[model samples]
Target chain A: MSSSDLLLGLSQKALQLLQEDADKIEKLIEVQMENLTTRQCPLYEEVLDTQMYGLSREIDFAIRAELIQESAGKQIMVKLERNLAQLYEALSQSKE
Target chain B: MSSSDLLLGLSQKALQLLQEDADKIEKLIEVQMENLTTRQCPLYEEVLDTQMYGLSREIDFAIRAELIQESAGKQIMVKLERNLAQLYEALSQSKE
Candidate 1:
């Protein structure tokens, strides 16, 4: 399958699992973000940014598809923004 | 960037974010897997498998690249297998 399709599938799966509890999903996302911040490579960082962005987009799709609750989606978004801010911090730190 | 590159980049980032805590990483993976299991489409299920397989390969690459601890890598593999089994089960259920 195409990468986009693959991502969509995984995103759908993830929503199925986590759609019931935004807090739990947010925590899991935090774990992912923590893993992302350890890399020093710019390319790697770009990849992280891209993946999170893509996942977020998929979450949006889930909402549009009516596959997930709006509250859950919003929780995910908040978590994503938090991780993104941390990612920015991590990226800036590596510049030193 | 190419899809492979994007996946690679994100994998590295995920390792960076999560290399320290195998349990935590596994939990996040479980969350992702749970999200993946909700889709009933064969194409979508294939996508989930592909994504996980790709991520596992990336983990192997990281091990070779000396980006993450070997023990952590093993943990990821275990978690991957567990999720894969669940994915299989989910796929089978949908086929019924």
Candidate 2:
């Protein structure tokens, strides 16, 4: 394979891995949203925050290593943050 | 550059980035250690733990992306963990 092909393959793989990690956080948010009216694990917020931090670090590292573009990483984070905000909003509404 | 050279350069860059992050955490530990006799932030341990988690996630992503070897990543974590343990020991000793 050519050098460009190799880099392309690596970049694609890095993006896929990052998306997978983000999906896990997405799942966590969905779970919390579903349980908003039922049982709420007090530590769910903390767990989600930690997971978000970890994913952000991975994205930052990938961008620095030239495996993924910074904009691509930011897009993934932006999408996740929107979902997280919805979840938090739902949680608050349930409390009221 | 050849494909192999490209991969080698990327791998080296990934390792260097990871090492730089590990070094930051090491510096955090050193600062805390130096302040052992002075004011304790009370949140230093929590901050350290969060930073460790972030670094571990980055290392994991690098290994999965094939930018670095699993053993290489583990070595970085192990070395930093040792220093973290030492700092914790000192903190505990000072408390006593």
Q: For this target, which candidate reaches the highest DockQ against the unseen true structure? A: 2
Prediction 2 TM-score vs. true:
0.98
Fill in the DockQ of model 2.
0.98
| Structure candidate 2, residue pairs in collision | none
Q: How close is chain B to the truth by TM-score, in each candidate?
A: 0.54, 0.98
- DockQ for model 1 equals 0.03
Cα miss at A92, model 2 (Å)? 0.3
TM-score of 1: 0.32
lDDT of 1 by residue, A1-96 (tens): 667765555445556544333444446445645665464444654555445544554455345434456787777677767766776686567557
Compute the lDDT of residue A31 as modeled in candidate 1. Answer: 60
lDDT of 2 by residue, B3-96 (tens): 9999999999999999999999999999999999898899999999999999999999999999999999999999999999999999999999
Deviation in angstroms for A28 in model 2?
A: 1.2
Error of 2 at A41 (Å): 1.2
DockQ of each: 0.03, 0.98
TM-score of each: 0.32, 0.98
